[model samples]
Target chain A: MEPGMISLAGGNPDLAGLPLDALGDAASALIREHGTEVLQYSTGAGIDELRTELTRVMARAGIEADPADLLVTAGSQMALELITAMYCDPGDVVLAEGPSYVGAISTFMGLEAEVSHVPCDADGIVPDALEARIAELRAAGKRVKLLYTIPNFNNPSGITLAADRRPRIAEICREAGIVLVEDDPYGLVRFEGETVPAIRAADPSVIYLGSLSKIFSPGIRIGWVLAPREVRDRLQLLSESTTIHASTLSQHLALTYLRDFDWSGHLDRAIVRYRERAEALLEALPSALPAGSTWTRPSGGFFVWATLPEGASADELFALAAEEGVVFIPGSGFYADGQGERELRFSFSLESPERIREGMTRLARASERYARR
Target chain B: MEPGMISLAGGNPDLAGLPLDALGDAASALIREHGTEVLQYSTGAGIDELRTELTRVMARAGIEADPADLLVTAGSQMALELITAMYCDPGDVVLAEGPSYVGAISTFMGLEAEVSHVPCDADGIVPDALEARIAELRAAGKRVKLLYTIPNFNNPSGITLAADRRPRIAEICREAGIVLVEDDPYGLVRFEGETVPAIRAADPSVIYLGSLSKIFSPGIRIGWVLAPREVRDRLQLLSESTTIHASTLSQHLALTYLRDFDWSGHLDRAIVRYRERAEALLEALPSALPAGSTWTRPSGGFFVWATLPEGASADELFALAAEEGVVFIPGSGFYADGQGERELRFSFSLESPERIREGMTRLARASERYARR
Candidate 1:
């Protein structure tokens, strides 16, 4: 980016409050003590200790996962890819939110799987709408094999799947024989909301993806999948064949961080900062966006999804925002069918509260200039 | 394995001679100094400095790689998978050596691609046979998309393609319109032998895979592919969609290892240890195996591929060896068609010289017992 540009485009985690120096010392100690094993190729299923620890991490999210059923992946992104590759054939329909995680959408596209969007409300995927979409696809003779969902604090749109709707969606998919993939990267990163029990907590068959990227560190690239016995078997083979396993060094570092460090304390402190930044963006959105424009007010997670006033183009606004020396993702990039032309996704994760406020001010000027034009 | 059992199955690098303490300090200092950047997500193409350093690494193997044409992958295993996914459709034939890397074969099978074996001799893949096999497959109206070759010290076979045949094989593949994937994880791990130019050096169309796993550390899981521009773009997209990127910390660690450390010096010391282990295994094999049994005398890398005497069952030998407290990979596992019932692979990279000799003694007793049975 050019100098002085305030980027609201990337959803990268804030690294300022992390225990970098201490973690560095821990990294040194781990490698020094366990260099031989950590530096060697591990079992294709992943190291036993990391998987055992991951069960505790999942337990905190209200899901009881067996270490035997868990497979450590490069990230939850890889888990998504593995599931899609294993189940979705070419032209197989995968149902996801209308505006879903761009990375998940790209994974489906890369594997030649057809993605169909299920409409979502503020509380997340409406149960009836999800059922209706599945039925419609079945009626069209399309095989709906998977329902990909970001159940908690979804990317681009920080809407959480309401706790009441969780089991309902899981049941709908179970009855429909469609695999339900609950991606919960931000489930544990909540600031003020009551903890929502994962859909997987009620359904054993649901494949749950959990990541430490939001809470611990993404640089380590550790994420895992908890699946049914048979699916876990297939995923292990897929993971072994492709990347063999996630980086052993990264996994060991994560293990050391989780094992020895005050990880929860670090996360609590980071959440405070994230909440403050979210408030700054939410506070600015009302006056910054034009009248009739609307946006999500997330209690936690990274983004606020804002829709431009009817007939205003987010694409044009994006260009104007660039000239104003700020940047954000145009919402169309998040959709499979380019239907979010008048929408924008503003991320508050990377910037400080002050920078976010200044960025919003610049965005307001750009919006006014766009409206005038 | 049970206590006292010798394992010659794993092709793990010997970490005994590695600078563990210094590396630990380096890891600490690197994370301390560059925590924020190293702890964040990197570009899909990988960090620029790592790729730039990779060119120098590849240059040592006589391949001039443009950083623009390189995509950093989790391992060469991933590079093979991406190429297979990009080019090979289901039922498309991928030609590989008769005894090939098990990981590569598994990758092809996982993606539903058909693997066809081209018969190999001690000098590695015979150019004439490779051409003949392609001609026969073409005549049979099969779609042959790729030729996967481990040109430098093959995993199970311990064979390197003769320098003179490299260009010929490249030409044949080019004429056959096949993508030649040169997987050279062990290229830089050479203990002795003239440095043969990579097939990719002669033909830029060939996709060259290089890994730091064999030379630096597999724990970090860093590898790269130098492909033609179009293929590199596809690989970058494939990589981005799945793992998103290799671990940022691992990449930064690799960059630091290359930039600040005498990595070549470390490899030299590792080579000495490897040479000692290989020599021990080779010396023991002559007296350990029955007369008429033969094995390749590898100049570098891991493994010594041995063919049991006529009518001997390596599977039976393996069982006996297990009882006698030793383990080896049966050769059939390395073959696509299950044609190597009377062969075995003994990896010398993991065990010390003393352990390798003891393991060979146990293997000889097993062989004699199997022959008696």
Candidate 2:
């Protein structure tokens, strides 16, 4: 972005909300107490403390997995790549929601896998639609390797998978013998939604990816996959040959922060803070957006998906958006087949309430200018 | 390894040899001074300070590259993978030294690229042989993609390419239009060898990989690649989508440490420490090993590559050595085609002098046992 542009594109954590003092205290304590181990090369999955903590955290989301089954990654993206590599050979069909996280889509394509999107409504993935699509793909003799999803607060759409659909989708994948990757990076970030049982809890076969990036810190680049032993073994081998495990200092920092920091207190504060910002965006949307524009009423998470007027594509207005000094991810960038032509995702992760309002006002003027043209 | 077993297998910085105190100071200072920015999502190629520092360090090796040409990675392994991904399509031929790092081999194979071996001698890859092989492959209608070589203290083989041959190989590679990957992770770890110009110094087209793992610390997983703008751009995209920029905290830690720490002084201590360990292993080898065994006299880096007696296989003695409570990597593990049958690599990086001597004696006994059979 240019110096004066207002960025509503990035889905990063709250910059001002980062626990600076706690992290410093943790770092100092960790280095003073376990400096050698933290700084030296580490082996065998990762630091045990981080893995164990992830397991406990997963339990809060209704996921029960042995710490032994979890493998640490550079981030959930690495875990996604690992799973993509392990399951699909090139050209094998991998499924995801219609508009998925661009990063995941990139990983699937980067590994040369064919990504086929299953359409979704407001409440995340529609189970019937997913089952029908799976059956249709099977009938067409396409090998559906895995189903990738961001069920809780899905990245761009900001829609939580309906509570009832979770188990049904799990059953469908299990019966179809297709692996499900439940990437729930934004699960614990919610402020108003009720916690739903994870697909992993419904079916132990699902590969669950969790990250501290959304909640704790992305700077650490720490995330983990709760996968079956076979998948875990493959990921471990890939890791051993690639990054050779997550940054040891990061694993140490995360573990120390997890153990010593007030996690619940920090998360509670985040929920209240994000909720206020989200509300501000939600409240401003109706007035600031053009009449035909519609967006999700997301209870939590980083973004709110907005659909522009019927014939107006976000791609066409991107230049105008830049001219108006507003920046957000164009919806077409999120699509697998370039289908999100009339949509854009506005991230509410970074800016304060007033800044978010100001950005939305700029976006509104950009939209008006596009409409006039 | 078992509790009582002595290991001469690990190719890592010594546990006690790491600069923990300096790193701790850096971490504390960074988090205190620049917490939010350090913790926030960083844009661009990498931490600017680290990239600039890499520039000065590369200059020390008689190589000149702008910071823009550099892309920091999780490790040199990731740099290798990124280069492999950027240059070669699946089934494209990637040539490597006969006994290159197994990690690189795995990465190439994992990406479904065809890996072919070019034989090397005590002074690293024979320039004439490399030229001949490229011609043979090109004549056979094989698409010669890249030549991957660890010219500085080559892993597993411990052979540095002779200074005079560096320019020759560079010229040959340039003439063949085959890009060269000069992995120099261990360049700064040198203790005894005269400083030699990097192959990249001769050919700016070469993609040079350097790591702080051997010299600074491995646990941070900091490595970088200096390449042309196009290759660097691809790496940037991969980094953006994959691990999300090599752990922002690690990058910050590295940048801060580079600016604040007594880097050269720390490197000097590391050299003296590793040299002592290498000397200890080198001195014990002649007396402890059976006649006919010869090892490369590595002036620097971790491993001492030992060639077993002709017609005898190190694979045959591995079990005996395990029973004898001594551990080292078998040479076959490093080979692409399992051609290092009558060889083994003894890493003198982890263990102390007395411990290394003890392990060597056990290896001698195990060798004597295997040779007797």
Candidate 3:
């Protein structure tokens, strides 16, 4: 991006809110105190202390997980990749929410799995739509093997699956014999509303992916997968066969932060900052967006899913926005098929409230020029 | 392992040799001074500074690499997986040394690729054997896609590919249209002889995998792949789609170590320690084995490959050895086909010379019991 550009593109959390000094001290103490453990090769299943601690981390979301059934990963992305690799044979179908996490879509495609979209509404993946998509794919001779969802606030769209629908979605997948993969990176970064029990809480068989990236640090690249014994065994084997294990130092750092620091307090302050940024962006959208444009009002999470006026290309708008010193991700890349061309995502996670307002002003000017074009 | 068990199984480096106090200070300062850069999600291609620094690391082995063509991975293991995933379709053939790295063999099989072994002798994979295997596989209608090798002191076998044979091996793979992947984690861990030129140095097209695990620390989980441009681009995409990136803190730690620390000096001391351990194992081997047993004398790297008496089962010996309070990896796990039942790998990397000597004595006792049985 150019120097003058105001990027509403990145989905990265604000690291400025992290307690760097405390974290640094913890990192130093960890390596100094336990150099052998921290700097040596660890088990493929991950460090036992972290795995046990992660059960406590999951308990916050009402998900009961056994340490034995948990595998530490490089991040939640690795967890998703492993699950997709295990379940999907070439040409096998993976059902995902329309406007699903792009990384998941890419992973499935990269592994040669066919990703089919299950239409989602403001409240997140619609159960009826999911069932219909699965049936349609199966009727068409596609083997639907897995359903990937973000039960908490999702990437790009920032739509959280309604609490009432969680168990229903899990049951539907269970009946279909489809493995439900729940990626809940943003589960703890809520701005409003009560904590929705994770889909994994309702279904013991769900392959739950949890990450420290949002709550703690992505730099450590620590995440965990909670799954049934059979699935966990295979994932563990895959993890062992490939990367061997996640970074030992990274796992240790995460364990230290979780054990010694008031991570909850840090998360609370971050949520407040994000809430202010979101409010600033939402407040400006009315004057900034073009006529007939619409967008999701995210209660919690990093992004606002916005739709362009009908027949308008968000790709073109992106170019125009860049010219006006504002930028965002065009939505076409998020879809399995060439859908969502008239949509885009604005992230309110990285910038301050003032910068967000300034970005909105630039976006309004860009929209005006785009309307003329 | 049991408390009394003397394990010669682990291939981990000695972390006690590392300057923990200095490393801890550096790690602390890294996050404190550059928290945003160190703690946030980074590019899948890896940080530019580290990529640039890795070129210098490769230069030690006479391999010239461009930073643009280099990718930072979780370890060489991840690099191997990405390459395999890209090149091998299900049922596609991958050729490896008869007794290859167990991790690589497992990775190939896990990705649904068919692994075929090319026989190897003291000087590493025989060129004629490799040629014969490729011809035989091609005639059998197999789609051979990749040739995986460790041209340095190979894992388990501890056999380095003769410097003269390196170019010939590259040529053979090139002619067969197979991508040659060189995993050289121990290229710099030589105890004797001049540093051999890497196969990548002889053939720029060879996809070279380098790791800091052996020389620095596996706990940090840093490795790099220097590949051709097209391959690197796809790898970068696959990396971005899956794990997103290597750990940012890990990457920064690696960069800091390379830039500021006396890493080469540390490696020299480590090599001296490993040499002493290797000597202890080699010196004790004659009395430690069955009458007709044979083993390789490694000039560098971790393991000493040994063959038991004719028709003796290494797995059964493993059981007996465990009863004698000693452990080693049976060679069957390192082979694609079940051909190494009489062989085993004794790793001298982790234990001290005195412990190695004691481990050898216990192994001798185990062999006697196995012979009696």
Candidate 4:
């Protein structure tokens, strides 16, 4: 199917939200000044300029980090894979949120790690539940290698971890001596919430992932990892044997963009725009959803998670909605056990308010038809 | 140490040889046309236009391939890792030349694969030694997964496989039901010799790896794999879970560079420049080399392989040469068993003729000091 034939299935930024002109200027300047070195093989760690910029960015988030602690990867996905390879042996236990990012689940599974789930609430993974799961796994004699989380505006769930819960969660993992893999691709996205401290700030053992794809562009594939020196060295060595380094040209261009442009202002505009479209979806949901349906009102980021009447299959709804000229990802695909049959996730990030209204209208018709049947 | 402190230690392109002006123009055009998309997350299979262009390029090398059979990776290094993960199980036997690309060797080792070496001559891996090694492993009931080779202008050896050996090597792998991974980063670099058909042409099971770094730019981190459909699909899945894809910005820029620019002409200039540098290094060798020391006269690529006198350590020589303001990679680092202690690899690609001569002179003095010790 054509990618544009969708309202909620795609994980893309609103095209209108990107700072196109600023990026164009940055690219031009990058080529004009550093074209030669930018086109050559760089150090495996990353371009130093980008690293330094990212360090300052992390500092603003309350995480005390240095360029030496960072290894700019192709994306957060690569960071996850490299971490898995470095930490998990075959049959190692990897714990994650019950309904997590499909990419993260797939990455750990591909490395042959046994992925176990920790149930999450409206405010992200339940700290007590996660601790219990870790305890149970230890009692069963399984070595838990790491716990993966997306604390800020997580995929599928679209829920942020509460500020109060962050430290307790970090403390639990630290006490258990398990590394926390914190993937925060959407932390900067502020539709209607106060910023919270990162898990890395609460615990130095946390391996934090950040991406330019969510706030800027997904195509560039620039992401980074902030971790301890030991973990950083292992990731660097593994990356040296993999891609060698993130694209030098991309790094240079990104560094130029960060330096020469007002990124905070750009992100503010993006947040305002996305919030407007998200509000449009929320306003239309009452008439569109079937009886006994419930959905989370996300404060920020891209998705709205919806649950249908009991026994109403999200996969079936997806097919019916597609036939009615709307599309959404079935929530079951996001679960580790593939059991979210009655749920669906709608993304308002890529569509405008008018298109989202049209999509939800079609979705309402499909839901009415399915309920009648 | 500063990257080009002396000479040959790094895998760098000759700055003077790079098509700097053309690259700058290409970068400018790329940003002007696709700045937003370049900064976004790209498809896991890679940018389609770049894949199509690479398909045509591979065809010119006599490997009849489709874009579907190609996967644009971060670099040839990522290709090696993906292939290793796709085909190898722990304890699998992976065969390669005794002295091979250390990066490839390290990747397989990281996967816990038992690496067995096949001896090589000046013209690359000896067919008889390869067959014997395969026979010994098979007799021992070991499952041989793949034979990794750099058939054209191999690293650390600076030797190209003879034209007649291609089919013979292919047939042996075919009959043994083992896959052949043909990594040819330096294949397009023909300084003086006629080009030979790739082993992929002789056997359908052979996997071919190509890089744009040597010819265009390494900073982009664009390389590709041409393999069977099954293997290609597996790599695609692995890539999906790995970095997601190579950098979208780099891929788009590379496509623009290949499609809108004169890549063939650029390559022609690179070959000419490398040839002149290679000749200069060859001419300077006589005055610098000790009696009993010898070097390979490479037809193409960046490195010149030199064997010092028996009982002389290349490690000691490297240290002495560095003291004298010359640097080269001690050849033992390239070997699997640390047996190439008497050899050194001098890269002629990144240095000027004058620098090459000066470096060789320093190396000669170091060699005499080591010989006496």
Candidate 5:
């Protein structure tokens, strides 16, 4: 174990690779050009320019949308919160993948909604299992309010839903009259494979969530939700009641960057950097793991989820790894039904290849010590 | 009818008065000095530097609070929404002044909480009426969950609560175990008289809301909630579910502005400007308004609430005013129940004294036209 820990715990992008100069220039230029208009309150829908750009951002995923169909939020998290506030009452059931983003689960729980995990496979949530769960929840007289999924490069899993199944998933949700919330914060971070059609492409009524957190800067906290008119109006009201609007200066900064910078070229550079980090961790894993240990080989995105030996507790491993100066998320935190006890999630988002290699070596040593215990 | 209309309907600050150059410099300096750290995700409590600065900002109000006791929110609007979400359940009662801020009533209603207006006089919500309303609500088996008030320089009323009555309001809430949300966005913008003590001074447990929007800029969306440890933690969770944190870049910009700018001098100038505008509106009112129309003589803040002649309709006057090329909020919009029909709220925040005089003349013409109808 190394004395200084290499944390693979957070899903934060590497600041070294970010377009810092461009962001700074954008903010400065916006304030200079617009004067105090950049410093005033915004319409709850956010600044018009940013929302127009967001439609273009969404169009990249093959989802056709207009500015009127979208509402700017504090981040994609607020988009999720607002959707729940708009649709679900307390005790309403929210079906999500068994192993998913912990933050979303926490958000639903905070809203007093009951989150029930549907079974998931290597290619997102299993369709048949999802359909069965919906029927079971309905049979019990529970209101199935929403079906939330990160169809592309899902957090913790780093797995994208197979493109062929996108329509089926949407159909299932629509048939049940449950709104499907497609949270796609990490979709644009793909290092390999062609861009898959968004679930919103399959169903235009889908509340599609998008963010600049992965590609641009999370500090700006700019994210948008594209939905039907009625849903979009409620989302705007939620923004009004909560944030009023995302920071007006942040929105203008986003607008300036979109208008003036080559974001696509910047994204290409980010992809190259992340792809290298992912490969380094993937290559080191086999040498580090004990027999029967297995992990996903992601083609894109931040995480590489690993399954430990049967009956091995990820919580116990997390404690030991921290003492040994290496850190990752214990996968139990992502599940609503106390599953994922023998799994861990490692993120290669912020770390360099050299740092990831050292962190994996430390993880290997920690596993050996725990196995002996 | 005048050819050029003047808008007194909005609550937006004057662009000419905003510290654009200083704000721009602050933003540029922050990004230049900190690099991408200013462009990253934040903890739910927000950045420490901003919260520390916020504590210093609050100290001027006689609030001796630690940064740990404060949670930085997207804005004071987010603070109000979080308080309602945290304390109230469906069907819970939220009591406020008869003519309070419209935004807040919408927020409580959006959360499915019933908003009821407590009786009010010029000196804000009458303490005796407040205590009686709480008792009445409790007697009816209703949960009197929150007492939401703007303690000084209220939004629609433009009236500060009497100094002696502040303690009584807090005591009433404390005895009933109801949360008191002290929304003080415009308190620090006082252009005349002494700064009154906060209702939070009488009870430290009060969830006091403060914003930089009134004295600084709203574009940054910087606001903070000062509460007890348990309440602060819950507010952080709500922040987590909503905006994640106030924009990290905005936080740094605010910190830089606080650290380097001559804020006291800036505020002094703002006070002087606002006082002139307020006086202009007051001076013009007698000649511009019809007989038996009375208005508040607020010592500070943006609003001047006026009552029209008996049975006069503010909405009817509003329609005529729009036709005559002048505008103000019909007081009906401010009340939770259908009341305040013969009242109007005129803001002196956005226009100059010269423009205000012309607008008042237009309003006078509108009133005469409506009276004949």
Candidate 6:
């Protein structure tokens, strides 16, 4: 795609928001200081410095975790894969939000786990729906291994679970004896509202995933998992047999970047920039949509989920929009049974406010063309 | 683990022999030219430039792989794990060399594959013994999904498959309709003698693993898998659900490093350095070993495999050696049946000649203590 092409297909950070200069500085410093060790086989868990720093980051986020409980992975995708391998046997049921991260859905499927979608509204997965599904599966003699959630700023849907729901869900998971997988790659990208307590704080049984991809850069591929000791140990064993460890150079560079750079300041700047873009898209939605169409207003994260009027398919709209030099991910791709035919996900992270407005104008034209037909 | 500690446990490239200065130059140029793309998610397969370069590297090693048939992974470990997931279901039998890379063994076990060991002699897996085992398993109505081998300078054993035996093994696997997984991490590390053609070259059914870890650096964690188109496609699907892809920064850095740096010259220098250390260990072994004990004289690679006399356990020896600040991996850890009681693996990659001699002296002391007990 061209530079002017406004794309909502990628789950990428704003390129203009990346601290490119800091990354260059960190890379240079890492090679100069730890070149010998950076080029060698590191500990199977990850570099100690990165893990330690990650532990501190999690603590500040109200998730009390020891560095020992963290396993720095290639990305949150690997973290999910490792957890899936450890907990899910073939045919085991994994309950997840109706519209979840496509990558996580595929990972569970690849392991032969039966992924059952739990219904969600604007506030993420409904607790009653989750409980009903679990009870239904249990009564049928099916084993539900994990309850996967993107509690804060969920992907594709861009919905965050209400603060009151966190404890209720945690309690239900505890009662059901199922692990809760809290994937929060975009938790730090808050644009408004007070910070809610993570699911991990509501219960120790939650497996929390954190990533540098959203706040820093995705190219480094650095992510971490915070779980209970048993899960951490099992994941470490699996990691030893997987990639052995995350890249030592990447880990070291991340450590240097975190240590020498003002990460919180960077994140604050990113949130402000993203919030402005998100607001611009929201403001343009009325003129860009059909009379009965609707869209989500997410408090944080990269995506804005939209649902078209009846009889309008987002998949068809995506093709039409592409013809106008724009791209988007059809929301059906994020659903388990491909049921979100009328919905679409638009990423506001990559493009600026001006481009997002233009992209929406193009999308509006395409939608009108399809609606007229 | 001091700076000058005679570290014989590391599976790393010789840092002194690494083209560090050239890598620095490449890093600067890479940032100046393609900083933006390098710090972005390129593709799940890999950067195109690196894949093309790897194809040439594989071709030179006698494995004619099309770039399309390859998927760059986080490391050789990831390649093995992904391939295992693709071919073997839970409880399926996977035939592996008797004393294999522990990491690969663990990966197969983690996937719940029933791993059975095929007996091997000094020159690697004995073809007759392998055939006999296959026949016995077949008669019992058991299916062998794949046979995994390190045909060139096998880890832990430091034994290469004899040239004549390679084709025979490949033919047997082909006829038996079992996949041959040719893991050649040490292929280019040959310090002496002619390089044997990879088993993959002789059998199109064989899946090949190539790594930049041994020859270039391990910290980058970049490796490639050359499999049949079907298998490669499956791995791509699998990778999409796992780490997404290897680090883009690492891939870009590697491409630049490979293109601009004199990797062949660096490898030559590494071989000479490691050979000197290997020779020093060999010269000291006679004095260090007890009567009836022997060690393999490896032509290349990081390790030297030693066998104590019958009734002498390597685990017991390792315990004593650890107290004296010397460590070696017990051979039993590499065996499927945990039967290598008298064997041990010593690495020569990390130590200098003088350090190797000193570590050998410490090991001798530990051996004497074990023998007396």
Q: Which candidate comes out best when scored by TM-score?
A: 1
Docking class of 2: medium
Candidate 2 residue runs with Cα over 4 Å from true position: A2-4, A139-141, A316-324, A367-371, B139-141, B368-373
DockQ of each model against the real complex? Answer: 0.85, 0.68, 0.84, 0.67, 0.72, 0.65
Name the weakest run of 10 consecutive residues (lDDT summed) in model 3 chain A.
A235-244
Report the lDDT of model 6 for residue A260.
78
Pairs that clash in candidate 5: none
Q: Is the docking of candidate 6 incorrect, acceptable, medium or high quality?
A: medium
iRMS per model, in Å, is 0.9, 1.6, 0.9, 2.0, 1.5, 1.7
Clashing pairs in 1: none
TM-score of 3: 0.98
Q: Give per-model TM-scores.
A: 0.99, 0.96, 0.98, 0.97, 0.98, 0.97
DockQ of 1: 0.85
RMSD of each: 1.0, 2.0, 1.3, 1.7, 1.8, 1.8
Stretches > 4 Å off in candidate 4: A2-4, B2-4, B15-22
Regions of model 6 farther than 4 Å from truth: A2-4, B1-7, B28-33
- Cα shift from native, residue A317, model 4 (Å): 0.6
What TM value does model 4 have? 0.97
Interface Cα RMSD for candidate 5?
A: 1.5
TM-score of 1: 0.99
Q: At residue A13, what lDDT does model 6 achieve?
A: 83
lDDT of 5 at B6: 88
Give the proportion of true interface contacts each model preserves, from 0 to 1: 0.85, 0.75, 0.86, 0.70, 0.73, 0.60
Query: Cα lDDT of model 1 overall?
Result: 0.89
Q: Which numbered prediction scores highest in DockQ against the true structure?
A: 1
Instruction: Give the chain A TM-score for each candidate.
Output: 0.98, 0.97, 0.98, 0.96, 0.97, 0.97
The TM-score measured for candidate 5 stands at: 0.98
